[model samples]
Target: MISRGNRGNALEALVAGLRGTPTDRADWQAVIALANRTLLTPDLFSSLARAGQIHQLPEDVREYLRFVHDCNRER
Candidate 1:
């Protein structure tokens, strides 16, 4: 199982990658795969969103974040 710190790092890296001038497909894919392997919680989701960088994320990632946020709310 992935550690919380590592998961957070992956999210941060993904955000950073998305915000870069030229996105890297391999890095994005690796981050997305990491995200898939790690369990996301409300607090982590909130932290990622609070970074104010969601606009830089890909549409699919944004949608996934929204879905996770909604799911967190439902809990």
Candidate 2:
């Protein structure tokens, strides 16, 4: 149930997360889920890496994002 309003918040959170802002697990989950649904997981991962903020994320989160990016690449 991805509401339109909530998607906006998730997108903002995604941008904030990409900018190296510290978010809770819930926020990360929301943004990641939204990105997954929208097929933007690779773009999100790319943005973080391109901005050199990938290292700011937790190791597990980075691993997950990388996994998604790799899977998408293989698709």
Candidate 3:
């Protein structure tokens, strides 16, 4: 399980990556891993969306985020 602290780190890494920061493969992997481990909350989704960061993400990552968002909305 991903601890809250680790999840926060993953979120930060994701945002940084989306912002065009020089993140490595590991950082990107961490974001994907955390996505599988946690649901996308409205606050986080809206934050990314409003910042236009979501559009900056890679296609696969954006798709995964959308999948998570859709799943969360159904719950």
For residues 1-75, could you state the per-residue lDDT of candidate 3 as single tens digits? 667876778888756644445244334556767645554333344556667666766677667667767776788
Worst 10 residues of 1 by lDDT: 18-27
Global lDDT of model 1:
0.57
Candidate 1 to truth, TM: 0.52
Q: Lowest-lDDT window of 10 residues in candidate 3?
A: 18-27
RMSD of 2: 3.1
Summarize candidate 1's per-residue lDDT along 29-62 as a digit string, tens digits.
4566665556543343455567665566578766
Prediction 3 global C-alpha lDDT: 0.60
State how far residue 43 of model 2 sits from its true place (Å). 0.6
User: Which pairs clash inside model 3?
Assistant: none
TM-score of each: 0.52, 0.72, 0.54
Candidate 2 lDDT over 6-71, as tens digits, reads 777888878676565635533666788987887877887888888787887778878999999999
Q: How high is the lDDT of residue 29 in model 2?
A: 67
Give the residue spans of candidate 2 off by over 4 A. 1-8, 17-26
TM-score of 3: 0.54
lDDT of each: 0.57, 0.77, 0.60
On lDDT, the candidate that comes out on top is 2
Q: Each candidate: how many clashes?
A: 0, 0, 0
Q: Which pairs clash (backbone N, Cα, C closer than 3 Å) in model 2?
A: none
Candidate 2 global lDDT: 0.77
lDDT of 2 at 67: 98
